[model samples]
Target chain A: MSSLLNIIVVGLLLGGIYGLVSMGLNLIFGVIRIVNFAQGELVMLGMYGAYVCYLFIGLDPYLSIFIVVPALFLFGVIMQRFILQPLQNEPMMQIFATFGLLLLLQNVVLAVTRGQGYTAPSKLSEFVISVGPLNISVVRLVALVAVTAAALFLSWFVKNTMAGKAIRAVTQDRRAARLMGINVELAFMLTFGAGAALAGLAGTLLAPIYTMSPQIGGNFIMAAFAVVVLGGLGSVWGAYIGGFIIGLIEAFAGYYLDPALKTAIWFLVFIGVLIVKPGGLFGIAGAEEVGLREQN
Target chain B: MSKTDTMSGVTSTRDEGGAVPPGITTFNTELLRIAGIAVALLAVTWVYSGDPFILNIMAQTFLFAAVSLSWNIIGGFGGQFSLGHGVFFAIGAYTTANLYINWQISPWLALIPAAILAALVAVAVSWPTFRLRGPFFSIATIALNEVAFVLANYFGSITGGPRGLTIPFKAGLENMIFTSRFHSVLLMLGFLVVCLIVCAWVFRSRLGYYLQALHLDEDAARATGIRVLQVKLVGMAISAALTGIGGALFAMYLRFIDPPTLLSLPDIGVKFALIALIGGVGTLYGPLAGALLIVPLESQLRAGLSASVPGANLIVLGAILILFALFMKKGIVGLVMQLWDRFGRKSQ
Candidate 1:
């Protein structure tokens, strides 16, 4: 029971991270309607960024989010403007371009880092909280709170803010949004940038727990995707909920089944969910009509 | 084929169809042209390149071509990007490898059942997962492939696990192990011939027509009375069977089987996909042409570059994929066909 609780707690914590990272992936798909296969590599960059900062400036990872997020956001905006915009007319082209970016980013990191593995500073790695009869790592607990708060804050931003409304407008109907005098291009740019920032934030938080490597992003990205699919495409809240559900499933499966089979087991869950509800748990039923299906 | 003749006449009469430039001829007729070109190329290589090592590389390329062709049936034809097909290849390798090791059974005899078993496994897994399209199906295949690897690891006592199993040194047509590279080349040619025939047969079948339709537009195909799900399953089965055979042959050629080579990150998985994508996705002859270009380019690059610059070729390979993905989307075969159209027009 104690072990089970541990697994559950760990799962929830990890799920929160998954949710946090996937928010960007989901947001880009929601607004821009492109499945950035490079999303994982972007997270890898953020982790590396935080790692570099930790080494040089001795910045705490949590505090480093302020730096990593903005930097990544700027990178994301530039990527959208320079690399992605040319292929906006073609969906497959977008996939290829981003896929190129994914390969480029991964190999560049491998080349630069020489595939070396790095861990965050000792304090961040060691920071853990032990409650009575329960042990909760402070890093993860803080990550969960931070991620939840970020998600809630984004939701509020989307609901209340004019820029958020314009973003939503673009997502709902790009043509209509254009007609209404919204700068659709700028909206897409900002949306993509913000989404990338979220991925960076997730990476910054996760750098301490997970070792930073060129290939590290591939490990959790699959689970993050499962969360995206489970939450329903383009629904931020759905991503958060889906993350927790997948986390719970992972926790239970890891506890009950072979630990090595955890990834495959979760993939099975992904397939099952896809079969049962293509739209996902909190997915918009007719949302597919609003998104990039037309482009494909 | 009537379709080819009609398409040619259409291209000559008026330019139409934006997806395929009207001046661009249909793929059916272009395949024959590809075969003619391939034959000429092979003849040149056969007469000139006296080096057995070069012939050896070509043999390996032929084997990869077969694997890529098999991948195309499901991935290209069915429009299902499967990253887990290494599982089927591994299954085929393991099946024959185990049979040869334990009973000293002839590999030729073992391979038949190995192919069947691989196909059966494909069907079993695909039946549940085919319902989920796109990334879900892809991830499931990846997961299942991993599961196969894990199982292979756990059963180390009998299966030989990570250490792998090796076929005893035996020379004969019966044993399926060859002493000469020429013999392996002949065997690979035979395999490629069979796969090509199968691909041509598929292109002429109702299932092929349905698969192409579904690939282009699933909803449209469904509306037109094409059963998209059934066709996809059939394509997947055919694909699995072909890869299984390729795997069985691979075991015979190497006379050894290991988990790391058979089932691992971005080894077979990357190569097969890269070859298919590099050649052309939908065309039958695309993979063959792709493997021909890529395998040599890869070997040459690795031999020359990796010594001076570690992972240099990988960077180049990634760049090439991106380039192909962006610009040469139709791949080498598609390019050949396009150029053929352009030149053929000038002569007309």
Candidate 2:
């Protein structure tokens, strides 16, 4: 019984990490309707960004978020404007381009770092809090809190803010949004930026917990894809809840089954969900089909 | 029926009619072209016969050209961007390796079962995934590759797990093992020729037209009474079968089998599509053109930069992918066609 509780806790925390990693990916998929394969690389860049801050300025990984998020936002905006926008009409080319970006970013980092692993030191990472038989690390707890807060914040921002509304309008119908005097391009750019910033946020938060490697992004990207697909595409709450569901599944599977097979198990669930509900749990029905069609 | 008529057909017809109809080349003409290409490749192989380094590169080029051509049957022509082809490739490699090692069966015979099993698996997996469109399909395929990777590692008895399987050296004609690099290159050349013939046959067939139509618009194809799922399944099966044979050839050439070597996305899965894209996604000769360009360049880059800076070759490759995606969507064949239309037609 105690072990079960521990597993649940572990799953929830893992889910929190997965949720944070996937938020930006879901946002980009939701708004721009382009699958950013390099979003994981963006997060990887953020983790490295935080590391640079810690290395030079001696800032904590938590505090470095201030510097990293906006930088990533700007980087995202640049990538959207230059790389993705030109190939907007061609989905096949988009996949090639982004995958190219993934390899470029991953290998460039490898070249620069020479494949040396680094751990970002944070005071908060060292703390642990125990409740009865359940012991939780503070960094993971912080990630869980951060994900919940970000979800609430994103939901409110999309609902209330003009920029958020514009993004939503663009997502719903780009032509209608264009006719209604909304700058669809600008909205896409900003949304991509926000999505990238969120990835950066995830990176900064996660840096202290895991040993940083150039290939670590590959680890998060697959799990995040599973989370996004399972929860629902473009649905904020769905991503939040979906993260926990995947997390719980991974945790239970890891404990019950072979730990190495957890990824395979979740992948099976992802494929199962994709076949059964292509739109995802929270996505609008038929959106999956509609999203791929030419919008302009 | 004249050579000049076929060469200058597009422009000559354009002058007669306002809009040019697509030049329909017969199977005999395609066969002649294939023969021409084969002779040229053989000439190059003969020139480099004594040089082990060049022969090794040539062997790899032919092997990948065959695999990429197979990918083009479904991916380029049929318009299904599958990134999980590594699974089928791995299946072929493992099957051939296991049959040769465990049962002492010849790889030549094992090739039959490998191709059949690969086709079966391709049909089974693609049936469900075919429902997805564009990026969704690509994503699902990537997931599939990951799943296969895990399963391969898990099933230690079958795949030999993470440590991988290595075949002992026993050179013979029946074993599909060669004592000389020249023999291996010739074997790979045979594989490439088989793939080229299959692609050419598919390219001019009714199924090919149906695939092209569906690739343009699935709903419209369905409306026009095309069996969308069946056509895609057939194309995928053919593609997977050929890829399986390529895998068997690759296993025999390298005399080694492992999950990463066989199934790595960067190396095997994506490389096939990348080669197709670089040469001409849907063109018959594109994969060959692409493999010719990429394989040697990659080998050179690996030789030069791998010692100084790890992953420099991939950086260059990644940049090239992005640049090509932006500037050259139609690839080398498309560019050559365009240039021919602009210059060769005018000169005539």
Candidate 3:
């Protein structure tokens, strides 16, 4: 009973991390409609940003979140304006350009740091609280609270805020939104910036939870893709549910089956889901056909 | 075979309903110029540049040219944009490598079956994936490739797992393992020739027109009685099969087979697509240009940067790629064509 409880708690915490990592990706992709292949590299940049603050400025990793989020938002804005916006319609350009950014961000980081990695011990992770037979780390609890709050905040912002409404409006119908006096370009730029900020925020928290490596982004990005696809293409809450489910699967697989095959197991499930539910579980049905099928 | 006469007639026709242009003759001249460049490249190999390292790079370029040429069929012409081309490459390499290792079958014989298997796999995957359009299609393929990689990693008994497999040393044309650099380069050159011929033949056929039509608009093509799924399947099948053969050759060249080396998204998959993109997708000679430029540049950068910063070379390449993606949307061939068009208009 205790072991089962332990798996559930641990799995939930892991799920929160996955959810946080991918929620921004969903937002960027939903509105911007570019896959942002370099999304993982943005997370890597954020972790490095926080790590630098800790190493040089004496800021705690968690505390550096304030700096990381805004800086990354600006970086994302610049990227969108300069790189992504210029070639929006050409999918090849968008795909390869983001891919170029992925290569650039990762390699530039690797070159600058010369592959040196940072690991900061967190006080929160050190504290352990027992819930009946299960002992959970405080850091995991903190992460769960942070991401859940972020999700709720995002949901509310989407429904209530003017900027959020504009973003949603543009996504639904760009030309219609433009006629309604919304700055469609600004919305795209802002959506990308916000998405970057969210990814960066996730990285800052993750840095303390895991060791910082140049390739950490690459490893975790797969899980994020799996979660996003499993949950729904563009839905926020769907990503959360999907993340939790994947985390549970990973935890149970690690304990029950070969731990080495955990990633493979989830990926198999992902492929199966993609084949069976072409529109995803919560995805707007027949979304892929909307833009392409209209002209014909 | 039947397409030769029709291709000759249509070759002079310009784009989109074949509007005859003042620069029609200039376009034919451009095609000749491209042919001349290919001939020159092949001629250079005859000088027998004795530098072992240069020979290795030269041979490697041929492999890349073949892989990218094949990729262009599906990705460039068919507009599928698969990021999982390496999955097929790995399938090919592993099939041949495993057969050679376990059964002692000659790689030359194993190549055909490996290619056929890869084609079948591509067809199977593309059946459901054809429903997806744009980035969603790419994401699905990437996930599937990742699944294959992870499974390959876990299955130690079958795949040699994460430790990877190495081929035992054997020499001679029979084994497809050569003792001389000259022989390796010669084999690769032949492979490149075959790939070029195949690509040229494809562009001259009705299949090419169907692929082009499908890429521009799928529903419209379907309405026009083009089998949208069939053309894409054929394109992917040919692409994967050729890539598989190239993989086998690459493994034989290095005499090693590993997931990171063959299956890595960056090294094989992206590089395959990158070569096509860099040269100019949909252009016959674009992959050749890409391979020629990238193979040498990457090698030089690796040699230069490995001492100090590990990834500085890749950073430079990445920046260049981004610049190309932004500014030079069509690549070197596109730029050249634009210049030629300007000259033709001025002369007329």
DockQ of each: 0.36, 0.87, 0.70
By DockQ, the best candidate is 2
lDDT of 1 by residue, B1-348 (tens): 212332243233222333355424454644554455445445644653567767777677878888888888888877777878998898888888888888888878887888898889988888888766554456567667766777777678655888888778888888887777777777887787678767767766777778888878778999999877778888988888889888989988888778877886455864676688788877776787778777777777777887766666667777787778767888876776687577755664
C-alpha RMSD by candidate, in order = 5.1, 3.8, 4.7
Backbone-clash count (model 2) = 0
Number of the top candidate by TM-score? 2
Candidate number with the higher DockQ (1 or 2): 2
What's the candidate order when arranged by decreasing TM-score? 2, 3, 1
Question: What share of the reference contacts is kept in model 1?
Answer: 0.33
Give model 1's docking category: acceptable
Clashes of 1: 0
What lDDT would each prediction earn against the true structure? 0.77, 0.90, 0.80
lDDT of 2 by residue, B239-269 (tens): 9999999998898899878899998998999
Q: Under CAPRI classification, how is model 3 graded? A: medium
Per model, the share of native interface contacts recovered reads: 0.33, 0.86, 0.71
TM-score for chain B considered on its own, for each of the candidates = 0.86, 0.94, 0.89
- Tens digits of lDDT, candidate 3, B1-348: 111221222232223212344223333444554455445555666564677877887898879988998998888878888888898888888888899999999999999988998999999988988778988788777776777788788877766888888988899788899888888988988888778767766665678778878889888899999989989999999989999999889888888877788778877888888888887887776777777778777877888876787887778778878999998888765765676476644664
Error of 2 at B153 (Å): 0.7
Q: Compose the digit string of candidate 3's lDDT tens values, residues A1-296.
A: 78888888889999988888888888887777878888888888888888888888878888998999999999999999999998777777788899889888998888777788777655565788877888877877787888788889988888899998998887778888889999988998999999899889988888777877776788767788888778877777877888898899999999899888887789778777777875567778765444333220
